[model samples]
Target chain A: MPDKRCTEDEVVAELADGMTIGIGGWGSRRKPMSLVRAVARSSLRDLEVVSYGGPDVGLLCATGKVRRVVYAFCSLDSIALEPHFRRARQDGTVETFELDEGMMLLGLQAAAWRVPFLPTRVGLGSDVLEHQRDRIRTVRSPYDDGEELVAVPALPLDVALVHLHRADAAGNGQYLNVDPYFDDLFCRAAARTFLSVERVCPTEELASNGPLQSMLISRLWVDGVVEAPFGAHFTECVPDYPRDEEFQRAYAAAARDDEAWAAWRARYLDCGGHDAYRDAAGLR
Target chain B: MSGPAASVGPGPATRADHCVVALAECFRGDGEILANPIGTVPMIAGRLARASFEPDLVMTDGEARLVAGPVPVGVEAPDVIVEAWNPYRTMFDVVWSGRRHVVMGASQLDPFGNHNFAFIGDRRRPRAQLLGFRGAPGNTVNHATTYWVPDHSPRVFVPAVDVVCGIGTDRARALGPSGRFFELRAVVTNLGVLDTSGPDGRLRLRAVHPGVAPEDVQAATGFLLPMVDDLEVTRPPSAAERVLLARIDPLGLREREVRTS
Candidate 1:
């Protein structure tokens, strides 16, 4: 097997403009913040981000990198709403395809299964159908039942960025936390996938680190691996550390105004690289 | 009846305690189903239900595990007995199975029980941007759904929701057999307990908290709420229930979430 280890910048370098990028993690937990920071600092434009969004979507929207967002919700968990993403939506900065959470999951699953769409009854009577009428279509069952269900289209992505607790140079990733979210699905649904991990362990150690079920991402689906410690900073990585509530509060506070955002961007986002961002944010 | 009534035991039951018990009563018969409560009071209510009356109800640790026991609220690392691992992905299996009863918060709720937490004004650009159309669309359509509104005001109890994130009685009825599993169980607010159990399937004043008159609830609502003929006061937490509430919420986080004043 090839050693697919790369830098966060290298992962960002592989991404192109107008690409659909699937971000892993569910609402501010286990996000690839290092890689997301690299994307924020990069000149990538007109990107469509699909996520169970948190600050990843917020940062992308704040940096003017996103042209569209396909999401169920963009929340900070503890913080009810993500401020930057809220501002972006309020300003009509990006086009949105807001689906039911289950619909989004089915879409990703459809892509991973190499199917055009997966039929479900999630968005039947909600405004989701009205909002996403252009993209989502209904299909009647071919069987005797003839029940109509929402055909959640494949959410195929150009690239996927995920953060895991540990990974091998061969690109197999494992999550130490209880919930793996949808990182594996994101990786399989994307054409290319990059994983950033807290540590790069030997392939054998990956199995020993945790249960076999924790090994979520297979090397077959991953294109690159970046060993960026605290890669999921500000987000909870469980046994390693919890979410930096204070830092997240500061981030949310900055999004209140352009000047505050600019100051925060300079102090954090534009500060050279991931290591510098950590140092500036006082993350030891 | 006046609002501040004495409880069966312990201290006088605050309005928050009444709301908690009312919210807990929402899951009284939801045996063995997953009780996924979203907000603070709802969380307390879910645990309260599980700890006391509805012991068969499944509860999570507010993260990923199906906890066998009621984990204390606001405790960083409470001793939890893990029954099963329920990741976000795996949760869909439970959600779609119609085996879950969720008590979620609503930014805007209408007489028909349609909820809107997506956006306020318009789809293109709204006045306020709340949590988008999350699991509301799916949850409402799939299983038993309830709403826990900590604040019951004209703003929340709207005439009609701006966006229907959760399918109401009207929309669900339109789906025919597709909406077979849809059940808008109840809506528990700070002021009173409301339900869409009327013949027309519209929100009706089921019961008011102690001191809160049915007229007061209707006055605070954006539209006139139909009153149940036998409207009664919401049950206050008993001394045993209060002890359980304290055990579940040792930090008194429920008080912070709901303010009677």
Candidate 2:
């Protein structure tokens, strides 16, 4: 029988320590906060995560769930520029490989295509790509007059865990937002993809619009789907829902001191497991 | 009529005054404020942090693919908008999707109004080899493009470019609305402002901020700069704009100050 869709608890239990994981969503939009909270409570630790700019990586660091990360930038858009990522880099708590916001998609695509590298001429003079020669290698291009070029290798993911607006029990899901291509490419390249959705609606009822309908994901690539409501709050953004600026302001204010961190750690980070955190996130 | 691109003669006091005055105009009712990209980190996040014209939930660029950015504060996160280069069919989607706003930087811009993505040379090849025109042609026609010439140099504002990677008024006019529309909005330079209108491809001087002079703009430009009527000095940041700006970007981006060379 095809594997039954497991609860958030079972999913967290399956995640072992030190695995490379990919979290879903944009800056504050579409984050798998429930699953992230669930992962925080588990005994497993030090899982390296690969993600673009967002609070998910910060959440992972705040909980001590991440050991290292391969990312471009992480911050709260201005509230408090990602203090966790900044502090980690400054203190050497975690190793980081920064890329540009533009090159983010290509890197994942490179991984998904299973190609060794993808060539582009993005950061030639800028300091953004200066130190990242390891991740980005300079090579000559055939298109140019033997001019130097750069190649960014594919970033294949082990498990792609993305939060969605709706899904069916079978994992045939569709994202309500206009964009699905961001995580869509990664899902194809990853070994297994996990989808944590807000509502599990019937496939036929996904959407009536043609553009939105074309972007839906079939059940073949999705390994599991977790039903999560209000899960994208704080980390993931819902268009009409409004971002929690108050909480972000509070987090920025509190991040200034060790005492504050301790309080935060005790209150939020140190969950016994998924069930407790789920209850906190109002997930029943 | 001197023509839109021709010298109408006013510094910041006049022509560019419209754009300047219009800055706070969009925000009249409730008032919409578009944060300017001034400093580094703060500049990067300015669009999201601004109280005016704030995103209801936050959105990524392009009408097609919502390349997720970090979900805005406190609100529930959307799928998250992240930028990508060749996100497979993403570029194709953006280009094909009718009208879209894109901001990109240019190193060299010529007199004929053509932009150089390939190495800059005159009739043939007379200059150093730069990053050859990468995606200019496709993007310029495909989207409502804006060329952000960060380092405003004479070489950049040239009479003609070596390689024709991106489209200019000539190209856009040829392509019509099916192609690119807004020829040039504001050439936000370190010195002053350069905006154009007429079909002759003439560039007029719009503004010379507080310290900037018409001479400086002329000396720095690669082509003949035009003049506008009744120009005033480009006003410095207001108390409110400055305070919020500092709060957002504590670390100064690129140059140290708002006023640059």
lDDT of 1 by residue, B1-261 (tens): 212222334567888898889999999989999999987789989999998999999988888889977677777645678899888877999999988999888999988998999999988888888989999988999999999988899999998899999989989999999999999999998899998976679999999999898888988999978999999899888777877777777777777777767
Q: Across residues A1-284, which tens digit of lDDT does each residue of candidate 1 receive?
A: 79999999998889999999999999989999999999999999999999999999999999999999999899888897999999999999988888888888899999999999999999998999966688899999999999999999999999999999999999998999988898999998999999999999999998899989989888999999999888898988888889999999999999989999999999998888888987997878
| Per-residue accuracy of model 2 over B100-159 as CA lDDT, tens digit each | 344445666655345555443431222433333334544454444445454567867877
What are the candidates' individual DockQ scores?
0.85, 0.06
**Local accuracy of candidate 2 as per-residue lDDT tens digits, A1-284:** 24446677777876888888877666566677777767766776778787754677776776677887766546565443566555444445665544544455667778888887776554442223444565677667676466554576677777888887777778877777655647676677678888887776666666652356543677887889887666676653454255667766656555567788777666655755445554554445
The model with the greatest lDDT is: 1
Q: Where does model 2 exceed 4 Å of error? A: A1-3, A78-80, A142-148, A204-215, A236-240, A271-284, B1-208, B211-261
The true-versus-predicted C-alpha distance at residue A204 of model 2, in Å, is 4.5
Off by over 4 Å in 1: B1-9
Question: Which candidate leads in DockQ?
Answer: 1
Highest TM-score scorer: 1
Our model 2 lands, by Cα RMSD against the true structure, at 12.8
